[model samples]
Target chain A: MPLLKTENVTHFFGGLKAVSDFNLRIEPGELVGLIGPNGAGKTTVFNLVTGAYRATEGRIIFDDQDIVGLPPHQINKMGISRTFQTIRLWNEMTVLDNIKVAQHGHIQYDLKDIFLQLPRYRNQEQAIEAQAMKMLKLFNLADHAQQPARNLPYGQQRRVEIVRALAANPKLLLLDEPAAGMNPQEIEELMVFIQRIRSELGVTIWLIEHQMRLVMNICERITVLDFGETIAEGGPDDIQRNTKVIEAYLGVEDEEIS
Target chain B: MAGRSGNLFSSIFRPVGRIVSPVWTALRRQLAQTPVLAFQLGVLVAVLLEQWQGEAFADLLGFRRIPRFFGIVDIFEPFSDLDFSGILAPFFPSPNNISASPLQDSVQALGELATTFVKAFFYQGPRAPGFFDVTFRVLIYDIVVFVVPILIIAFLLRPLVSELLRRFPKWSLILVHLIILAAIVLLWGDDGGTRELVLIFMGINIILTVSLNLVNGYMGEFSVGHAAFMAVGAYVSSVMTMWAFVDDRVFGAPALDPSWGLPVGFAIALFAGGIAAAIAALLVAFPSFRTRGDYLAIVTLAVNFIVQSAINNMEGIGGARGLNGVPLWSDLSWVLLTTILSVFIIHSLVNSTFGKGIIAIREDEIASELMGVNTKRIKLVTFLVSSFFAGVAGGLFAHVLAYINPGNFGILKSTEVLVMVYLGGMGSISGSIIAAIIFTLLLEALRPLAILKWVVIPLILIVLMLFRPQGLFGFREIELNWGWQKAKEKPEVSGATAED
Candidate 1:
């Protein structure tokens, strides 16, 4: 069975359908890309799967559990974590604290243990801190761990978001516009970073991006969405050549898509 | 019979309701938009109405009379009869006895002034027995009364509560609550005096400051109407206790006597107050979903006014005249227990995973929700818990004073709590506690200043705000650790650069 599956998921905000009949199936440890023009509902799909938005009509099954109508925190606890399209690091918190907060769902100490600073609380906190530092080190953010996240440069903030997401030890990680504001060099670095996270952590990755170069270079499978509907789904090369995908992006003959 | 009575009630009020509904709605809308202005307007209207109509207006509303504010002299009454000159005679050698020169006399006078100021700062009034006057047996009695319960609660009962919390979770809070209540009753017996009253007030203030800090500081939501919750708690609990214990009350004969059932009645009253406050908070919480920061501040401020007005108009509970005959069940033991419990609950809550979620919402609501933190629920829960404790503080306040008035919980009361929360540094529990103690002490210490006391306090506050706006602790949390243990551990690093 697939590790994650979404069947006939549809969502509407008033009269406008944000996402309609969105179907997805991902095998374990697969790195996939969701590509679309602005307002193509790429991020909406991530939202639905992560339980940030409940599917108006469909099933979101993660690890054999139907996650429909579950709260986002519970969904995260179920081993699904996602980064935001806009970098959403806790600006006032230290880089380490931002990552430690993401690991909140997995912290195994009760209130009593924490209040008394029991061995269980101490050990778990230390372990989580150690794990966060390791991820920070991987992203070259170890030195910056003590600094407030907002103090970091834009590119480093994006990296910290990914590190925070990974800190949750999610089986399936979702990245929403990770390269939104990065320079070309940073984008290249992000591609390698994405690949390294997948290979080293053995986590399934799904990323939504407007950067075609990063998507085309790294994604094994690519799904194209347009006007709240999936237009094409195949390998990256097939998606690049598909007429429907081309039409969705560039528009057919002189007829504007919008 | 009930249906007929209800119908009759509606029929009698229906026409009046129709006439007043539109005006009330318009007033409410105006109040919602600019609550501070509405509050000022209400005060102005009240003052104008009082001047224009005088006793007639008050009589029509069932307001017997406005109670006099407790004067500074009234507060220092206990100390007035005592001869403090005797205590200070040895500290400052008499110029007459020493045959001192003019300069030496002046220096001796200065020394006497310093000693007097120190005494005033530490004074608990002369009514309470002095430390030296109490016999060794009484000392042992005091120690046993205070320490035995604390030791039992902390050592024996705490582990059980902790275990229960881990296993049952929901039951643990109740278990802890019962333990504290039992300990309070057992320890306090029937002790009642000015020192106990002051300590109880301090405890309640600490609870208020810490709880308000939860909403205003940790959540980064500006809530300046915390006293409204306290008012709700005070009124509900006061009414509950009055009904349960006090005879010949508005609600008729007493349901329970003050003798054996007083403790139980007080406990129930405290719980009722907390629940009532939580319910009141819900009324504000729904609006808070769409509003925040300055808007939320206005909403809370309006809530404070609404609650005070509602209470003032409630003639059954004494209206503007204030409720009296509330049994004095709150002692230092009860206050101390509740304060400790409040601190423990709030501290544990903020440090837990749930606490991280709350902090996350404060940082970025949309981002927290997107990250799966359930921002709305976290916010609601935080508000409810904060208000619940505020109500608890109010209940304690009511019991300690044995009387309550709507005027007692005005905008000024809320602002006092806000000051403590901010002075302590929002989000810092220990900071709130320290600030609350200092603030309370400062208020008491300035008692000798009379009306000028207010000026001195505000001036000090202004200086503090100007210098340390982030508060005494800022955003730094004091983590509970076995001192230096955390600092000793070093992070293991592999030799690899970012390029590698």
Candidate 2:
């Protein structure tokens, strides 16, 4: 069975249909890329899947459970976590605490334990700290752990956001424009980082990006969206060659040469 | 049946084993780090034991009563005993006996007035060298009666209660409540008039400071209408108490006699007042939270005005005339009990995951919600709880003063609370507590200055703001380290550029 399946998901923001008849099925550990133009509802799809917005019509099944209408936090706790298109790090919090805060869902100690700082609270905190540090180290952001997130440079801040999402221990990771403001060198590094998270952590990856080069180079499969509808879905080479996908990214001709 | 019974026994023993070993380990670690705390604990335990054993320890030590300091009475006794008439006779012409003119009589009267003023403000009285001996004695006596108990109780009981908290935390709160109740009884039963009143006010201010800090500091919401909640509590509780206990002279027929049902009735009134304020908070908070920062502040300020005006117009509760004849059911004990309870609840809430959510909302609501923190519910709950405690403080205020008025809960009152919260440093419970005590004491001390008190207070605040804008404690919390609770260790992030 697929780890996540969304069938016929539709969403309307007032009268405007942001996403229509969207469908997705992802097996465990698959790296899927969602590429689209600016208003193609790529981020909206991630929002719908993560329960940030309830679809006007459809079902979202995750880990064999219907997750529709669940709150974003609950959806996240149920093993789907996402990063924002813009960096949304808890800016005032230390880099380490940003990661620790995301691990709130998995923390099992009762209020009594936490308030009193019981052995359980200590043990759990230690575990969470160790895990967060490991993730930070993995992302090469370990040196900036004590610094406030707002103090970090833009590229590192993006890395910290990804590490924070990973700290939630999600089964599926959603990256919205992870390569948005990065230089080519940083973008290349991010590609390797995404691949390593998939291979090493065994987490399924669903990324939304406008960087066509990065998407085509790294994604195993690509889904192209335009005008709130999926125009094409195939291997990167097939998606690149498809006329419809090409027309969505470029422009449509007045007369098509058959 | 035998197997089931064995399993039950093991289940109980398993937890007990886990609890005892860790507690023992923590205790050992605590003792190693802070041996003074252990010593203080020992002294407190000994005092408790002595009390339980019917003062055998005190009797053996030849102590008949707990030592006391030289009070106002002791300082004034010599002055009162002095024949002031004889001393002032040479300074003033005799008006009555010598049958002087109107001018001489007026001059004699003026001289008397000057002497009285001088005596009252500057001089307590002429004192012998023996007075110095008594002063030293009183200072030593004060250490035993006041200072030692506080030190022992604060240091020793905190850990013990916290340890008990790990097992039965709710019950531990009751233990704290009972201790505060006992302290109240002990202090109120003393005949130190103005000092006791000041202490009671301190308790009320602590409640205001801690509760307001919940919304303003922790939740990062600006609520300038805290006094409105207090007014709601004061009016509701005062009305309830007056209706139930006061005779026909005040308002309506008494539903409950003051002698028998006053405590129960007063308690119900206070709880009702808290609930009423909480309900009011719910109405304001639901809509106000939609707006952020200054807009939210303006909404709260408007609510404050509304509450004040509403109270002002209500004729039955005395309207602009203000309500009176509220039974003095609130004592130092009640104030102390409520203060302790409020602090415990707030402290526990802040330490919980729920508290983390509130703090997260304060930091960044959008980010907190995206992280799955249910920010709306957290914000609502925090507002309600904070307002509820403010109402409780209001109820205490009503009974303590034995009067209620819309003027008592004005914008100025809210500002007073804000000052305390800021002065103590936001997001710091102990800081709020210290700030409250100091604020209350400072206000009381400046009483003689009259209108100038306001000028001096603002000047002090201005200086405080200029130097320490974050307030005294800033973002730092005073978590009593019991060794088991490890301090948050920040890993030094290497100062490398992201390009590297």
Best by DockQ: 2
Tens digit per residue, CA lDDT, model 2, B165-222? 4565444544654664555444434344766787788999999999999999988889
Residue-level lDDT of model 1, residues A164-195, one tens digit each, is: 88888899999999999888998998999999
DockQ of each: 0.24, 0.25
lDDT of 2 by residue, A34-65 (tens): 98888999989998888888889989899999
Most accurate candidate by TM-score: 2
lDDT by residue (B1-500, candidate 1, tens digit) is 12335878878787888888889898556334331212322333333343355345334423243211112223332232333343335446766665335455566766765665555445545543222222332334324333343333343333343344445443454454456454433333223544355556778989999999998888989998999999999999989888877774566767776674456778888988998999999999998767667988989999999999999999989999999888778877777778988898898788665577777778987667656565777789889999999999999999888878999999999999999988889888889988997888677655645655677788988999998998988777654321122342346445646452
Cα deviation of B128 in candidate 1 (Å)?
Answer: 28
CA shift of B235, model 2, Å: 2.2
